[model samples]
Target: MAAKRGGAPANKIISDNRKARFNFAIEDTLEVGIELKGTEVKALRSGKANIGESYAAEHKGEIWIYNVYIPEYLQGNRNNHEPRRPRKLLLHKREIGKLALAVQKDGKTIVPLKLYFNDKGFAKLEIALAKGKKLHDKRETEKQRDWNREKSRLMKNLG
Candidate 1:
């Protein structure tokens, strides 16, 4: 596991999509649970899952996460799971309705920000209702990040 310097809670995290913040203007976030298979859980425990290219979509009045890669567990000789299978995301009925409405009418996206296990060891997803950022907006965000870094350095030296 990587050092928990300034990111998520070190123990529970499986994988984090750090670039989601840079690519989207997140308007709201929700903690949703994930349904995984036996081998998938083992893969996650080994910290070999990738949610970077994964996204949540509504299907048959339910939400599912697509394109997430949970690599097959090596020890599973023949019963290993698929690497890029669509997984179900557990959410409240109202929340799913709201997200579907937003995507249908408001042009918003359901992006997965991070993947981790919660306090009770259940796999959870940090999803966000977001709008895609424009090129100029991305440039502005980059500038702000650089300025923040410089300001922090100056403050550290002075104090």
Candidate 2:
């Protein structure tokens, strides 16, 4: 009889905030753990989480993410977690200090870019230190994206 060969688990993305890139100029990103209830974890595993409107900020010396929506686990019944509760993010003291300083001194914002299960099956949130884009900057970004899409089409047609 052959022994079972269980390989390392793969990182699985549960949700992404695609508009974050278009709305802000990202300076840095960090992957931090999230403290979630059992029902929340079950809901996320079903790929029903949304981080599109979520943002992280320092609160009482710790970082907490707000507005992230993890729907109630249908099977959880009476023990379901809140759908839009503020969740605490886990990070090193040094990293938290850096994020806090950047937000305080540089007027930057921390936004959740993605939420996923890491290779070890633990849930992680990728947060970005970003500066908000001005109206003109946003228009320029849109123009550049349009040009890139046109260029890609031309290249594909030629090739």
Tens digit of lDDT per residue, candidate 2, span 1-159? 996367645778999999999999999999999999998998999998999988899999999999999999999888789899999999999999999999999999999999999878899999999999999999998999999999999999999
Superposed Cα deviation of residue 73, candidate 1 (Å):
1.3
Candidate 1's C-alpha runs over 4 A off are 1-11, 157-159
| Tens digit per residue, CA lDDT, model 1, 1-159 | 975465445448878998999999999999998888999998898888889999999999999999999988989979789999899999999999999999999999999988888766788899999999999999999999999999999999999
True-structure lDDT of candidate 2: 0.93
Best by lDDT: 2
Off by over 4 Å in 2: 1-9, 152-159
TM-score of each: 0.88, 0.89
